[model samples]
Target: MTIFTLSLFSNPLYSQVAVIVHATNQQALTESDIKNLFTGKLKSFPDGNPVIVLNLPEGDPNQSLFNQKVLGRSDAQVKAFWSKLMFTGKGTPPKEVTAEEMIKLVSENPSTIGIVDSAAVSDKVRVLIQH
Candidate 1:
């Protein structure tokens, strides 16, 4: 079980991360929009609908890759950034969730967005962008 779990996390096939929203959502979000949403900078869709952003736990493989490729920062840096924002009463980081929950919430809520491994994506959620 330990080896299986380790191999799952280390697999290159799952290295690609996908940002997803509700399947019926038609929002066209750019990379900057994604970065801002994840960073607590942008809170709404172009239509002015507020979003509920979800993230995988800190250090999760997909989360780490998303941070590097999309956010252009390390996981620790992201944690620190949120910490400072919270301390200064400026922002709140997205909620941390498992990959399964990400899919569940995003699929169920049109106003929600979240990340998951590219391979884990199902028809339940719509892919906004991948990184």
Candidate 2:
């Protein structure tokens, strides 16, 4: 795999790293799905129940990288994106936690998925898809 840098209109300091989620729960998540999930447009997996996506807390390095590179937004932009969606009753932003907490949450909650630096991956969770 290769890492590529992304320079968005707003944030441009994203690191090149694979953002991974739980493998078994989501076979393959399109870029749109990921964007929707982050933006709160889509809730739940292909299944009927609500899907809980975990994210590292604000200012976290991995979170910054994942948002800019994978989600294509800076923290402020992401907040604004969700503000619009949530106000419209279209979607809810993923729950945010610390990196370690997010990892543990994803590892225990079958329906929970999170993004993290590839180097931080462990056997605690199954890597579903990467981008």
Candidate 3:
């Protein structure tokens, strides 16, 4: 399974992932900030506004890359982490949506942040970083 997963990511088409937010957000984020947001470490933007993290549904290739590259965890590990957080009432995981839906959500909501395949980024959303 690990070999197959590695091979899927080895494809050049999936080589880059972009972190994005509403164009109006205007907040610069480092990779660490992004990791914090997704892991429930940093709950709000630096300016104090609340944030909503978005993720592609489990098992999506882009989602796998985002989890591994950004969050440093596998899909099941992320799920278990969030489950524990939710069980203890410490935090909730990012809401899951399809890629198309993620674009729409991030474009419509200033506080919504997500990652997507670099090729899918559009004018509606601003790229914070590419990895």
Candidate 4:
């Protein structure tokens, strides 16, 4: 039983993460959409609604995972990318918030979207995609 318990704890399948948006948002997003939004490539939903993107504060585990899985970039790389964009007046990075704050903010704004650990997801937001 101890060995079985250890195996369960070590399983990679447990590390599920989700991309979320306000429950009222009806736009369906693919992996590319999520990547583009987070990377400052796509500024609006496919339906033409303006988007508000949120990120977990730097060094947070969920932020790391989302950056790796969705953006295919590291935290430092993301920062550098945003810095260049900001310096050039080309684009702005997403707003950073705590995981708890993200839940509340995304829930309140119909145009907002964010990524969070699957365990933090609740009924207030809709799961747009899982990674």
Model 2 clashing-pair count: 3
lDDT of 2: 0.69
Q: In candidate 2, which residue ranges exceed 4 Å CA deviation?
A: 1-18, 86-91
Error of 2 at 81 (Å): 1.6
Candidate 1 lDDT tens digits, 1-131: 69999999878755789999999989999999999999989999989999999999988988999999999999899999999999999999999999888999998999999999998999999998887
lDDT per residue as tens, model 3, 1-131: 69979889777655788899998999978889999999999989988999999988889888888888888998999999999999999999888899999899999999999988899999999999887
Task: Quote the positional error of residue 99 for candidate 3 in Å.
Answer: 0.3
Clashing residue pairs in candidate 3 (N, C-alpha, C atoms within 3 angstroms): none
Cα displacement (Å) at residue 111, model 1: 0.3
Error of 2 at 65 (Å): 1.4
In model 1, the clashing pairs are: none
Over 5-119, each residue of candidate 4 has an lDDT whose tens digit, in order, gives 9989987556877899998888999999889999889999999999999998999877888888888898899999999999999998899999889999999999999988898
Output the TM-score of candidate 3.
Answer: 0.87
Q: Which ten-residue region of model 2 has the weakest summed lDDT? A: 1-10
Q: Per-residue CA lDDT of candidate 2, range 25-97, in tens? A: 5546777776777666677766666778777777887777777777788889888887887898877777888
Better of 1 and 3 by TM-score: 1
| Root-mean-square deviation of candidate 4 | 2.1
What are the C-alpha RMSDs, in order, of all predicted structures?
Answer: 4.1, 6.2, 4.4, 2.1
Count clashing residue pairs per candidate: 0, 3, 0, 0
**lDDT, residue 68, candidate 1:** 91
